[model samples]
Target chain A: MEVALETNAVFVGIEYLAIFVWGLSGGLSAVRKRYDLFSILTCAWMTALGGGLVRDTLLGDLPPVGITDKGYILTCLASGLVVAVAHPEIMRLKWTMVAIDALGLGLFAVNGTAKALAFGSSGMTAVFLGMATALAGGLFRDLMVGEVPMIIRDKHLYAVPSLIGCILTVIVYKIVRAGTVGMQWEMALDVVIVAVVFVLRMVSVACNLTFPGAVDRGGGASS
Target chain B: MEVALETNAVFVGIEYLAIFVWGLSGGLSAVRKRYDLFSILTCAWMTALGGGLVRDTLLGDLPPVGITDKGYILTCLASGLVVAVAHPEIMRLKWTMVAIDALGLGLFAVNGTAKALAFGSSGMTAVFLGMATALAGGLFRDLMVGEVPMIIRDKHLYAVPSLIGCILTVIVYKIVRAGTVGMQWEMALDVVIVAVVFVLRMVSVACNLTFPGAVDRGGGASS
Candidate 1:
């Protein structure tokens, strides 16, 4: 029997929270870039939803849910509008933004990995897809704003945290399957993965950690 | 009755040519950016195949042919190696590169539009998908290297030609369906769309034509 990852009450709540945070981060990027309203809104929408769209597309899920979900669209728009109107004050709370971004990354990583498994993907594929989902939005936003993707540079442990979370997800999933664990155990493990990812990513961002012998090699390992 | 798009003998030839040229152009961009050999090869692969992957994903086609097909991958890699190793003279022939790029755009636009329709997309959706297919690879390459996408700037007739070709494809498809036209006529129309797109794009590049209102606000309009 195959296990299906249901978007339960907690999952749904976390998704909305993650989306809003993603939108806020996207708005911050737009403000920093000094983009006009149209571009700002677009950036918000894409950054909040583009990852899911790309993930679903790669999975051959037609008519991406991100495009069809009205709540997600409204959340992105609301965040974009708010940031456009009050960007100076919002930009000042840089740490707050980073904290929210870390949460978004963890949530997306765990959710994407679970979805991939539910879709019957192999463990490795699920891990790869999960990291891709976690990073897609930021990559899209960076590209649109004409900047090199930070993930590509291996800086600040961005993809690293997501990758670790995804790997852990795969491990937990296999254990649950092997032992016939209950849904409650699966949920607990999922939460643990998200927490681990959040802590790892947030610490790296706060400490300005960088990946060495990989990229940005000549620079100091810490800012 | 469903309409099927066949990648026939001529279409296959043009597609390979386009992929090779796209790879070469990507290699050129990598060299200009002073990227390492690995980066240059990755750039080439993305530029040559990214558009098709995006298009196929939109159409819910799994495992994009670009990735699954070894021949296509080899073509891109070979083209990248050649251009990366000997870019000085290749870079000098700017006009030649532009001409080939035009042809590639035309072929991709026509092919993508037909594929969308084959997958049961609406005519307008097909047109949109087609232009996106023509533009996606270039956009990916630009963003990867941290530059504004030229298509967004709208300085050239890049997207315009593709859009026209896509619309033409729709019209042809409708005619073929309504009149019960044979496969030969359908194939002929496909060729016509490609030719028209190629000619329009090439002429614009040669004449430095800029789309009015869309991008270049102040211009002679005729030029």
Candidate 2:
């Protein structure tokens, strides 16, 4: 029980970090569009919290922490304010942003999967929700800005890494429950899964790995 | 008690109609984009159920009816298939579609506000979620098709009508609860409110009513 409590603290810490990074990315999008202060802050909040909101909602978690939790809300808003004031050329910090984003992705995917499982969701549902928790924020951000969501448009490794992480988390969770694994071991495994997701994402980026395009766009029959 | 049960039946009937209309609209969008069968079906389902999903989640309703109810799922899928097979000239039936869509907007707004209040949400939050429940589906459909959401861009009388309906619903609900009004009277008022919303939306569209564009686009100092 003590180990579980400690692990929860670590989970929350990473979640906050992920939220802040995602918020910055969203704020940057608004800045690029030259939107007003209200729009910038709204975009940042949506990008940081949208995924978790969806995940929690699907898992039957009420009054999603995104809005109810003062800490998470403040972190997102502060991140937006920082970006609005700094207006840093994010491209210069592209690598750093990518790294943080990958961390956030892994954290969200693993944590989301675990939460879904705890809520009695099927494994398939858990995996999907986990990916949704990692990706929906960016999707909402893109929609707010009138852009096609990068996850859908880009053929990059973003979603694939999240998918892999969620699947592994579910597998590990099932094994831990079925075996005599201690809480500490389970917690360690969770961390390892997150790390693996991060590494896979980074490697994909470095290697320029991507999924293939649709076999034929506009070649199919109408309707 | 009998009146309350009858009113609930009426409410469910209207909700199903609203879902079907919204699904058709979403499927039409995907069809126009020449999306594949899978994409069309997905888009339809999203457009029909997305709003309710968001609303229910925010209101702490678990396992949203949109996903868990086989009836809702089948309705959405059937609507998609109909659109796919028929390839209806939606524009030629523009006025019909508008009327039906307006009906849906009113139904969703009123139902959403009522549900939020029942769930103990504040008046302001209830109003916001009500509008969200009416708008989110179309927003999701637009995002899926890579377009700027009409709700955000068109400035049409669409969202305003929903907002008005929700506000009115809340006020009436409060009055009914405060006074010694019978359930039958409250039910009548609900229907009246929906009609009012429908008429308002139709009138606005006929008059080409719209909110004004941003007062100052690109006027602010660089972030």
Candidate 3:
């Protein structure tokens, strides 16, 4: 029981860090669009918190944390402010942002799965929620900025990486329960899943791997 | 009991019509964007069905009807095809589209309230749901196109008109239940509410009415 509680706390910390990275990316993107400061902050907030808000509302939770918790809002605001002020330097740190975003994706996948399980969702539902948590924020940001969602269209393993991470997390949880592994081991297993997702995403991007095309140019059917 | 069922059926019909109008608007917008036929159809479908999808998911309903119902998708597709083939000439009838949109808003607000009440939601929640149903589709469209959500930033009475219509619908339902009005009169009440909402929105637009400004233009405050 103590071990489970400790694992939960670690999960919460990862979730917060993921939110911060996502918020920063969204803020920078809004700035690129020449939006006013208020619009930039709005985009940051939505990108950081929108997925969780959708998840909570769909689960019939009241007053979603994104709307009710001052901490979450403050985190978004602070991240946005930092990015806005450090825009020149941050623009040169593309690889760093990509690395952090990969980490954010892995952590969010685990957090989403755990939260869905906590809410008593079935395995399929939990997997969907995990994917939603990891990808929906980026999707929202892309849609808000009039770009095709990377998960939906880009030639990279974005959604696949998140999906793999979620599947790994769920599998690990089930295996640990079946094998009677300790709570510390479960946390370690989660870390391994995150590493797998991060590495897979990086390798896929390097190799230019992509999902089968869904739509072809020139109005022809592809898939 | 017969009267109650009839009233519910009328509300449902009005809701469907509202959906059709919103769907048409979405279809027209997609055509204007010069998206290929499939992309136009997808955008139109999302615009028409996105609001109700959000509402139902928030209420814990699964696989929102917009995804599951063949008729809904068909309607959106047909609307898109019509607008796409009609070309730029269709854009000339701006007043027609605006009038239809206003009527759709009123119908959607009333339907949202009725649905919420049927689901046993509190009165305040019902009202919010009504406004959400009326505005969410347009919000999704704007967000997808990388524009500030007109409902959130514009000073127009867009959402306010829906709010009034929803409140009036709920009040009428309550009064009718208390036997203060006959069944025929209760039906008339819904029509009156819709008319009032349509007029209110048109007047507000014509008069350039807007909400009080909340954010300062100058960079005085931190993000």
The numbered model that scores best in DockQ is 2
Candidate models: Cα lDDT each: 0.79, 0.80, 0.73
**Winner by DockQ between candidate 3 and candidate 1:** 1
Per-residue lDDT for A116-139 in model 1, tens only? 788877776677568768988988
**Which pairs clash inside model 1?**
none
Displacement of residue B135 (Cα, Å) in model 3 is 3.8
DockQ of each: 0.12, 0.13, 0.08
Against the true structure, what is each candidate's TM-score? Answer: 0.60, 0.60, 0.58
CA displacement after TM-score superposition, residue A175 of candidate 3 (Å) = 3.7
User: Model 2, range A1-223, lDDT digits (tens) per residue?
Assistant: 2222126777778789889999989988877766655456667888999998888776767767565667787899898887777655453678989999999999989888887888888889989988989999999899888988899986669999999999988888788888867656788888898899999899988998888765666776435
Ranking by lDDT: 2, 1, 3
The residue-by-residue lDDT of candidate 3 on A1-223, one tens digit each, is 2223225666667667777888988877777765555446656877998877777775667545565566777889887777666665666777877887888888878777767766777777888988888888888787766778767787888899899988887877777767878656878888888888888888887788877765668675643
Instruction: Give the range where candidate 2 chain B is weakest over 10 consecutive residues by summed lDDT.
Output: B212-221
**DockQ, 0 to 1 scale, candidate 3:** 0.08
Two-chain complex of model 1, DockQ on C-alpha atoms against the true structure: 0.12
Q: For model 1 chain B, where is the 10-residue window of minimal lDDT? A: B1-10
Q: In model 1 chain A, where is the ten-residue run with the lowest total lDDT?
A: A213-222
lDDT of 2 at A70: 71
